[model samples]
Target: MEPIIIDGTAKTPTVKFDSTTGVMEIKGRSIPENSIEFYKPMVDWLDEYAKSSKDQTVVNVQLEYFNTSSSKCILDVFKKLEAINKGGSKVLINWYYEEDDEDMLEAGEDYESIIRVPFKMIEIVE
Candidate 1:
């Protein structure tokens, strides 16, 4: 399956979803004007990927910040991945946050609680 690669902009994050390697990445700020619109493709892509997903899927999310709207959309993305995990494939979410950014860490923990999949909270120095 072809990957979904979206360059980050002032209002969005960089998205790199490579099905071949079962590795997906979302980084940068995610405060898009239309959060739902921006994330729909990702959710859709996950839908397609689920059909023939890899044995292990790893998603790396490193966001500096995100708005309330973007937060829900972000959860939607995680929910999709959770489904993939429930389908028997191992799914790991590596959530990266700045060492001093407690809010970001809590945000990741929130998603970890909501989603059934396992999550690794990675603290980035500096």
Candidate 2:
């Protein structure tokens, strides 16, 4: 399947979804003007990827900041991954945050509590 590679803008996050390695990485800020527009393609890509997914799918999310709209979009992405996990394949979400970013860590923990997939919170040291 074709991968989703979106370079980050001032208001958006960098998205790199590679089906070959089964690693979907999203980094940088995610406060886009239109969260649905910004995230729909990636969500659609996941729909396609789900058909022939790898045995293990890992999602790495590293965001410094994101607005409420973006947060919903992010949850949509995670929900898709949760479905994949429920389908018998393993799906892991790695939530990366700076060591001092308590809000980011809490956000990840929030998702972990709501989502079905396993999440690994990684603290990035500057």
Candidate 3:
């Protein structure tokens, strides 16, 4: 599968899905007007990837600040990964947050608890 690349804008985050290694990464701020519009294709791509995916899949989520709508979209993305894990594939999520951002860390923790996939939280100093 080809990579899904979306450049970051003022209101939306950047997305990079590398199908070769099954390392999907999303970064930057997310506050899109229509959350579905920004995440629909991504969700679709993940679904397709899960069907023909490798044994190990890693999703690296590195978002600075995302709105409530984007939060829901992120959860949807995780759900897709959960489905992949249920299919006998090992899945890991690396949620990176800024060192000073407690909210982001807590958000990651929340996702970690809710998701069945193995999740690692990392604090980056920037």
lDDT of each: 0.95, 0.94, 0.91
Residue 60 lDDT, candidate 2, scale 0-100? 96
Best by lDDT: 1
- lDDT of candidate 2 over 1-126, digit per residue (tens): 899999998899999999999999999999977799999998999999989899999999999999999999999999999998988569999999999999999999999999999999999998
RMSD of each: 0.7, 0.7, 1.0
lDDT of 3 by residue, 15-118 (tens): 99987888889999999877988999899999889878888998888898899999899999999999999995799999999998999999999998898989
Candidate 2: where is the Cα deviation over 4 Å?
none
lDDT of 3: 0.91
Mind giving the per-residue lDDT tens digits that candidate 1 earns over 10-96?
889999999999999999999877799999999999999999999999999999989999999999999999999999579999999
Indicate the TM-score of model 1. Answer: 0.98
Off by more than 4 A, model 1? none
Better of 2 and 3 by lDDT: 2
Question: Which candidate model has the greater TM-score, 1 or 3?
Answer: 1
Error of 2 at 116 (Å): 0.5
